[model samples]
Target: MRSVALDLGVHEISFCEVAGGAVVLRRTVRSLDSLEDLLGPSSSPARVAIEACREAWAVHDTLRNWGHDVLVVDTTRARQLGIGQHGRKNDRLDAEALAHAVERGGIPLAHVLSPHRRAIRHQLAVRRALVETRAQYVTTVRGILRACGHKLARCTTEGFLTVLSAAALPAETRQLVGPLVTALEMLTPQIALADAALEQLCTHEPVIVRLTTAPGVGLVIAAAFVSVVDEAKRFHHAHQLASYLGLVPSEDTSGGRNKQRLGAITKQGNAYLRVLLTQAAHTILRHKSGDDPLRQWANAIDERRGRHVAVVALARRLSGVLWAMWRDGTVYDAQSAAVASAKGLRLQAQSIEQQAQSMKEASVKARRRQRSIDKGLGATRATARSRPVSTSRRASMH
Candidate 1:
């Protein structure tokens, strides 16, 4: 069997062809195009291997189209298995290593998204960038306003840009900040356009449709979750899915015991997905509608610990729920949600009852104090009335 390996060197592409576990041909190729001239058409089919990189997928697709088996491996694993272990690092060695890795099945083939999926991801990415940019600009306006010594009143109707433009301020402050208002005005439409594009994209994806069916998950989050997770079955279990999304707790294990360190999320997966999930979880907890097990768990945690921990835990659970739905092809069930939410609601009601009891106790105490004061005042009045005319001067009265 013959195998070809490509090393995307810094300046040039290195090509190595091996047969029977020996290098039969080695050459430097300028581009993927140069492969045809370097290695002429062969009678026997050849397997091609490449290190996973930005260009790796393109090469893999092209070579596969040309009737050759192509394997794309993790660059890190390739380095370790081929060059790192051997203490040799060079394009030639890398190419040889990739070939060996492919032959030995040490390199698991990389997955490539379909063209349609690729287009969808690109659209999602663009929308994400626009949203981030708008947030940054909004933050800048808020900071600028804060610096001008104009503290916004609570519950003000004005947004950052609106306040900046409308708030009465010194001429210098207006001059420095007025242009920002205009910029925000211009940027608002761009953000709207991005949102519209995202909405349209979401409409085309079935997974997003199903995900949006869940309470607390909006179109942006559903779409992002769908995009980041192209396959549901990749995860062995729902917990694995949650862990992959970084919604799980961090573990500190020692002395044969596992303890949750209670820190920030492990954040071991896609950060954007994690953020979306957590935000969705937060929204779910805040919304008074529909029941969710994750929300119940979160609220319980919140009461015992805090809302912060509850929200994070809820986000992790949300990830698990998504995985369950995707893996089982099941829709959200009101019965299940009800069962889950009952625990949280009961806890909430119990908390309210406890608070009411405490309030009642305080009221009783307050009433008793008022009664004591009133009684003392009445006694003093009676004593004054009983006394002979006290209005006279003390020395004259005696």
Candidate 2:
């Protein structure tokens, strides 16, 4: 089969065509629109290779739509295939090397997220930016208050303003901190809008709902997992999912007896998703960690190792749970015995009400608090005004 490689760039793309282990054609096109001259519609379909980057998706889709098989090759390993060899690289060299790699075969490929998943990931990124920016403003207020000898109680981000109101900060201090507080008030509604948008997306996605059945796995984390993994079936099994998410431990070994070294996790994949998974693990192990066999197993690891090690191990395990849940279309079963779970999803599907009522029965606590504070999350809406409304502030409200 003919092999073609494209070096995608912001303003231009270098194209190379390799046939019979030699470069037969080369061209530098300023735009994908110019491809008709080089790869006309009547030309035979060729396998195309492109380095993984932001533009790779558009390139992949464009080539596939044009009747070409596209491979979004991994950028790091492609360097080994003579790209940028001995400190020399350019668009033409890169494109030729990619064409040669494609012709040679067995080049590592990157997963190209479907358009739907890509859209969701982009939306989630917007939401994360809004949330993290709000958090920074909130943190600034905390530092300023602390310097002023006013310590606020630990409260949810959404209730930070409420907590501030209860603190009754001095008039001069309020004036000094007024700008960020106003910013927070402005951001709260926008963040809420972002959340509402994501929630609306979740309504159509049954996988998000199903994944959250795992303990401590909430709506946002589930959405992130779905967006990143995109399709669970692409992965052969749970361990592949864990490895894809970079949960597996790093290893170094030799052929000799007992010559092996295992270190920290490779941490090769999405950092955000891994952080959420660890957070979920900590939440699970925080209370009644021995509540089930899996939790107990994590707890045992905790007893043998440290909290940090145990948390990561549990996160790794949780990845398997998520994959199993998605692959098997099953919810988590806290009731499954150790023996039963050894083979497959230790979980049997149950009704929504049944799970909820049973969970409440298991852990009954007082209801003094009417709300919850999520990590880096703030209030959905502004409540009582922190200071007397000024004419300028009232006008700015519009």
Off by over 4 Å in 2: 34-36, 39-44, 255-257, 287-290, 337-398
Using lDDT as the measure, the top candidate is: 2
Query: Which pairs of residues collide in model 2?
Result: 157-378, 158-378, 158-379
Put down candidate 1 lDDT per residue, 1-398, tens digits, no spaces: 57788898656899887767788889887787788754335435678887777787677777776678777775544545656554768888888877776566656655566665665667778867766766676677567768867665433212455555566777887677667665655555555555555556655666665555566766667667777777877767667777667776677666776653555668876798888888888888888353555566677899898988888777776776666555555444434444543111111122455445534543453355345445434544654576676456666867
Error of 2 at 323 (Å): 0.7
lDDT assessment of candidate 1 = 0.66
Predict model 2's lDDT versus the native.
0.78
- TM, every model: 0.71, 0.82
Alpha-carbon shift of residue 128 in model 1 (angstroms): 1.3
Predicted structure with the largest TM-score when compared to the true one: 2
Report the lDDT tens digits of candidate 2 across residue range 51-91: 99988998788778778889999886786789998898999
Model 2 clash tally, residue pairs: 3
Deviation from native of the Cα of residue 285 in model 2, angstroms:
1.5
lDDT of model 1, residue 235: 68
